[model samples]
Target: MKKLRYVKDEGMNKKRWLRGGVAICLSAAVLSGCATGQDKQGSQKDLANSLKVMYSGSEDYFYQEFGMLFSAVYPNIELEVVNTLSLENTLLDQYNQDMNKALDAFIEQEQPDVVLLDPTTITSLIENGKLYNLDTYVAEESYNVGGFNPGLHDYMKDIGGGQVYAIPSTFRSQALFYNKDLFDQYGVPYPTDQMTWDEIVALANHFPTDGAPSDRIYGLEMAWSKELTEVVNVLATAEGLNYFNSDTMQMSIDTPAWESIVEQSNQVLTSDAIFYYDYIYSGDYEASSESSLGDPFLEGRLAMKLESNYYIDTIEIAQNNAQDPEDIVQQWDMVTAPVGLQNPDSTGYSMFYNLFAINAASTNKEAAWTFISYITGDEFARVQSKQSYGNIPLRAQYFDKGDGRNYAAFYKLKPINNVPAYHQVPQRFVYEFPSMLQQEFASISDGQLTIEHALSELQIKGNELLATEIMSQEELKLYLQEQQDVLGPGVITR
Candidate 1:
């Protein structure tokens, strides 16, 4: 196994403050209820029991509301919900050191019962044995493990194994976010669930570019970096070209699937339908950008942008720039990514979200599990679906809400009916693989290098990184075996 590294410069100050906030919120809620100690005995027991959890937070209103609601239910639990400013800051401590000392120190000192870990952080924590194996917990409780999206569950289980280390809290998938006003102005058909990439291109080409500011409106835009590269990878995978071959332990960007990806990107870049000039590159997807594709889409300068459900919040925020923000977003809608001929079933997408896990060393294991169960349970899933404007539910029933009321819009936009099978196995190569491929692909997109050369070099450089910087094949096998021991034998396969 690879050596565990520590994050640096972590402080418990924010955590302390958040704990205080929860206490204050719960106290207010309890006092406002006017129910005495005897009347609220059961409630008090549920609330007063202390439990600590770590999460990522932003100005997103839903997160705050969820935290407050969680506190209200378990008044005694002393919910310590810490929101690290960003995934990178919390996980790598600004990349200051080879290790994550700061995060490690906090985990060691506070010993939070439950943690909301992102995929990147989950990878590190699982490797270090800092998280509990949740497989037994799920099986013993009959926790409806099969209720979530099979693809997403497989992705998590592959990473943390059958141990069920984490439960997905939310999901964000890439989709075509279009400006309704712009589509109407150009007399373009409103985006539908059945639209193909070629059809999207054709729609984009209908816009008149008559050398006027208004004529400059284009078809689509995407944030071109490691973050957005997942879209391309998803599309390629859907086309039947796996990025990594676990059996051969090799990267396969040299295949025709990869060629299809390059061709698709190139077509978009060089297309007359869109404005590919002044490409804005940001390492982080959620960063604030005045000229971001989202901004332009809101401004009516761009017709469509490829983004995730998380962008729905940003889109609402961006509407402040609009003369009529409400009407714009109300009319605005999203659709699944364009389909390909080879993988007619391919979704051309990927899902990103935060996962909730129990700490291996948590003092309050039962409390932690209770909290995890409560938040990720079917009840919470329904609440979350309503509160989080565009978040896709991981639970199957939530998606299957037959009336087409809750989260119906999101499920409608899903690219494929069947979940991709690749997510079922943890790809040891994911640690640094996506970012590496992103860099190479970006160069090719920018015309700095040919796709052929880039893929050839990527294969060689990727192999070197795997051999030297990543876990050896033997070590990976051992780790997989350990994961299976905790999760169960069927959690992973060779």
Candidate 2:
């Protein structure tokens, strides 16, 4: 019975964030051999156990394909899969409710052995104790926690209260993808993994300003206009900018970290070197188009762009299906994404992570761990990495293969500790606050507001929103009472 901490407010249940930074102890568990489950090496009978799995994202391809792979490995073990629907899209209210009901009913009736959920749904599942704590099995088998991306292991620990509730099976992080052919033509040295945004911007302007009449070309393209939130997030996260004060709960945008991000953003906004991709929804990601505003790299219009591993399949598809394969991405390569001025570990931006966990109330706990261990093993990672499933395997070595080429550097960069509220608030406020402040950002970009005015406006408005969000018990009561007083006894005469 671990002491699990949770947010007290019912509406804000999504705020399952860890307060104060804590070093990962699971790594210690791995070394100390401190786990407690029966280390049962299994036979065909153990392998014959039937397991239920819930896949939160993907419907048609991922599950159907993985089912075959899992079957080939353990011929006797049966996998029953149910998809609650993809979480990649903006969750609609009715859809959210329906999916919630389906999952709730599934868990209640089926009592699944394993659950494959995304980060967005894990919070709710964790609160309900649908996922099991994996400490015992991990310790008993000496499961190496250090094998995972550093920050993600920390995140799992925080989510599970010093235990392991979920493991990230797939992940995709932003990287600095460059065109070697373009760089060669310009005689500009390839971008280094450690280069800063400021440094990259300088390099982007090095190529010829003039180009062919039909398609435009640029030295570098961050596509920041499409991923503005990520752009802002990476820069601010590097400086460890938590949006609000823990004691006061007041939002503070006055920090030097925020200032640095704004300055960097302004540099990009002013440079005209970036390509502003369209903001079409995520569902249209695979559809054919002119690389959308979000992907100048894919259309061969730009030398470089910062993007996630998901882009690899898209580029491969474009190359394989194109009339000419050599021209697509034209000798493309990637390096670790640039770190911010504050945290120089070369980590920032976002990564789409897929999670796996044993159901907390499962009947076949031991056999379930057996299945969980095998599928998440390095061999499975290797197999899955080469597939067209679009999931980037967690282990780096899986990307080590291929024609002396593509994805050689995939594992070189590490995942960042995504600061949930970076400001000690919930993600809704963090995302919303940034969006609201976009007006000021636009003001700065459009030259309507000076940097000073923009900063002041962002601070003032951001604080007001934060105040509303973090209202104290007393504050809430007073506010409600004030509203009641305004109504003045219901006006019976009316």
Candidate 3:
């Protein structure tokens, strides 16, 4: 049994040492290899094989990040990564009605045993019976997946129409990072788990906002830019309100729910307690702030900011680069991202990007299953946890990086049931809609337009924009098919 280790933030030596230890443990447990198909009674004799994998990145990168570690445990099984950049580019070049035909040809020619796909592509393939079902394999091996994030397996099963077709080794999540010292200095209480958006804003209002532009302390900073629309979008997403209806191809931003969100967001934006990195440094202090350092939160000025798990990497890098001990963000921790008032138990800020699945047409199902199982296993997650900065491990225990910090905050809330409606809308619509919103919001902020009149005007303008940009159903289908490769492998194919 493996026990967790405590890691100090003064240096990254412990992280490096632990990663090295994980490699050693993997070598010692070579025969087990997560006890997938390769380790079974009759499978071991036939384990010597070369497995082909389709990945979005270069072969060297795949080998460096994953292939090397896997080889340490399964020396006989050769891992071949089939880089799809060229194939993806070719698909992107000629995007039309025959896009699926071209994709089919590419798949037949490549015949990769395993493939890394986006969630949307995974769903499409699952629907078309082009992906293998892993439920039978999982049940046969009695694989214990109870350690994964809550509802994650069920989420995948739902995507695959009641069967598990793909698995993600890691996911992306955001949390509310607060500076403990700032809270203590301002005599404000620390934020807790499952906070509602309104509750968070109310708490932020408690902090004093009087000071110079550069030296001021802010209660909250939700985004890097001063875009009120961006902050409003976050709040609206938490509330499960679709500002655009994909099926109808119309704007839904004028609704009461949206109106309320905009009103609240406007209040927060006008309040001096909220900080926008761009706004703060746009004037005389711009040079000083830029010269002083990176990340005001790290600079010990911002009270709290809702940021992604990647922020940990930023913090670690700051600590490593700090020439003076005083420059470090000495005390900080995180809590769950803000939720909606009605649904305070879940958040919409979580996403799984790299989904691994076995090709149903492959003759090497055994080997492919072994590879997939190994990558998604608890042991693999343990090693990967220390290696990656932005990715949240699928396994529950590994979330605790032994750093004695509140790692649980990243995974504390259940993911919202629905994917964002914007994903389903046309790509052009999604890209252009935000600008229209911002223009109208700017008018309201300048006191030239009332909220009611502004929303009404927005609804009219948005419909016109949608009408001009909308593609026919069949055309939309072909467009999505052709553009998947162009958007890169990580794009969600909603």
Q: What lDDT would each prediction earn against the true structure?
A: 0.57, 0.58, 0.70
lDDT of 3 by residue, 1-494 (tens): 11212222323643443454555544544434444424544644576388999888878657645676677556667888887765555643444323344345556678889978766455556666778888988675445678787768777786677888888765878899999998999789999988887788888888887877566777887855666677788787777776666557787788787788889888777666777656644552331232124356777888888887877876775676667646767799999898888677777887776788888899889888777777777766776766643467788787776777788877777766456434334455554556667888888888898888888888887787767643544666676666675665546333
The per-candidate count of clashes, in order, stands at 21, 9, 0
The TM-scores of all predictions, comma-separated, are 0.59, 0.67, 0.80
Highest lDDT against the true fold, candidate: 3
The model with the greater TM-score, 1 or 2, is 2
Name the lDDT of candidate 3: 0.70
Worst 10 residues of 3 by lDDT: 1-10
Ranking by TM-score: 3, 2, 1
Q: Kindly list the per-residue Cα lDDT of model 2 for residues 1-494, writing each as its tens digit.
A: 12212112312311111111111322232222212111322354655368777776454334443555555555566777655543222222223323444355566665778777555455566677777888777665446655654465666676566777877766666677888888888798898866777788788888765643225566765653444444565456545566566446566676666766877776666665555443223232222243232344655657887766666655765676666565567688887676666666636554535567888888878767766775666656655655544456766666655655546345554445443423234333543565566666676667787766777777777676656543333554475566457655542121
Question: Pairing residues by index, what is the TM-score of model 1?
Answer: 0.59
* RMSD values, in order shown: 12.2, 13.3, 8.0
- Identify the leading candidate in terms of TM-score: 3
Query: What's the C-alpha lDDT at position 268 in model 2?
Result: 63
Scored against the true structure, residue 344 in model 2 reaches a CA lDDT of: 67
